[model samples]
Target: MLRNSPLHPLARFLLNIISPLEGNTLSAVKNTQHFVRIIKEQHVTQQDLLVSFDVTSLFTNVPTNKALDVVKKKLSEDESLEHRTSLSLNAIMEMLNMCINTTYFQLDDEFYQQEFGVAMGPITSTQRYIHGRL
Candidate 1:
């Protein structure tokens, strides 16, 4: 829901710019079809097995505090966020924490609030996946 907000894209863009680059990762599979093309080009035979797995309910499974810690660590290591942007790294980190920590849902005359884990529809989902727990 908040993704469509006017400031969301701008925040996302800024985050993308300031965040430390992963450069290469297994998660790149989500970004392109080249993995298949490469496998085909290499003539991967029936004997050659591929082992790939995805975590189900990742949004609910990842611990938000851990994810935030990873972001905070990476932010501290990368100096650009402080010098180039008006937002403090701690402020940026808190914003991410706020985004993921305040999750909730309603189901069948019941309401539940998430005490941990990222909220649905956040751009930071990829970060949680990449960094894992602190």
Candidate 2:
């Protein structure tokens, strides 16, 4: 269903707009290899501590409204956004709302609409955006 949904293209478009603006935060890891390299380079002793997190219901826990606000603020503050796309921030925000807010899914031949948080598949980076903000 996602392949044919009008929002799919819009999601891609929004991703294109926001992705470049998603400047790397200090906590972000590019991939497992990079993370492993960093870990291997770290000199750990008895005083050093290592911790990990396992978030439950990760995508569903992200507040769509708050995520949108973060995206908006990021876009508005991004100096390179104009160089990336010709679309106004308002236009991008409108499409983002449509993509994030109008998600639906099917289960057991029954259609269900999400009432809160980011949808599971569409607009995957939304989770990252929310995580950085929240």
Candidate 3:
């Protein structure tokens, strides 16, 4: 099971480092309530437009390379990263890439590799990074 996999701990650790940095972004919202409150507080005119998108197959369709690039940029710019963890930025990125790219699954007697996007279940940390960064 993925939960017992060696990379799972590393994914969780990286999530800890990345989550804090992610939540500090201006676009980050605590929840739907927070987002709604912010929208309500805004002063808007008729000319101002509110827009939203319906992203079909959002999780499976996320471009992995683009997500990694964004996370790399965020990690590089984080001044507090050294205090947060001893792992160098390069090391963290490498492990993250390994964890994400190395994902595969077994079905009965068959095994298959995921060619795109992180798996949709269990790996909530990876999902958060993609959702927050993108």
Model 3 CA lDDT for position 115: 67
* Per-prediction backbone clash count: 0, 0, 0
The segments of candidate 3 whose C-alpha lies over 4 angstroms from its true place after superposition are: 122-134
* Candidate 1 lDDT, 30-83, residue by residue in tens: 344877765666767789888878777677667777877866776777756656
Tell me the deviation in Å of residue 90 in model 3.
Answer: 1.0
Which ranges in model 1 have alpha carbons more than 4 Å from their true place? 1-27, 30-32, 37-49, 108-110, 122-134
Query: Considering lDDT, which of the candidate structures 2 and 3 is the better prediction for this target?
Result: 2
CA RMSD of each candidate after superposition: 7.7, 6.8, 6.5
Relative to the true structure, candidate 1 has a C-alpha RMSD (angstroms) of 7.7
In angstroms, give how far residue 33 of model 3 lies from its true place. 0.6
| Model 3 worst lDDT window (10 residues) | 125-134
Find the candidate with the highest TM-score and give its number. Answer: 3
Cα-based TM-score, every candidate: 0.55, 0.75, 0.79
TM-score of 2: 0.75
Residue 51's lDDT within candidate 1 is: 85
Model 2 ranges off by over 4 Å: 40-48, 122-134
Query: Quick one: ranking by lDDT, best first?
Result: 2, 3, 1
lDDT of each: 0.59, 0.76, 0.75
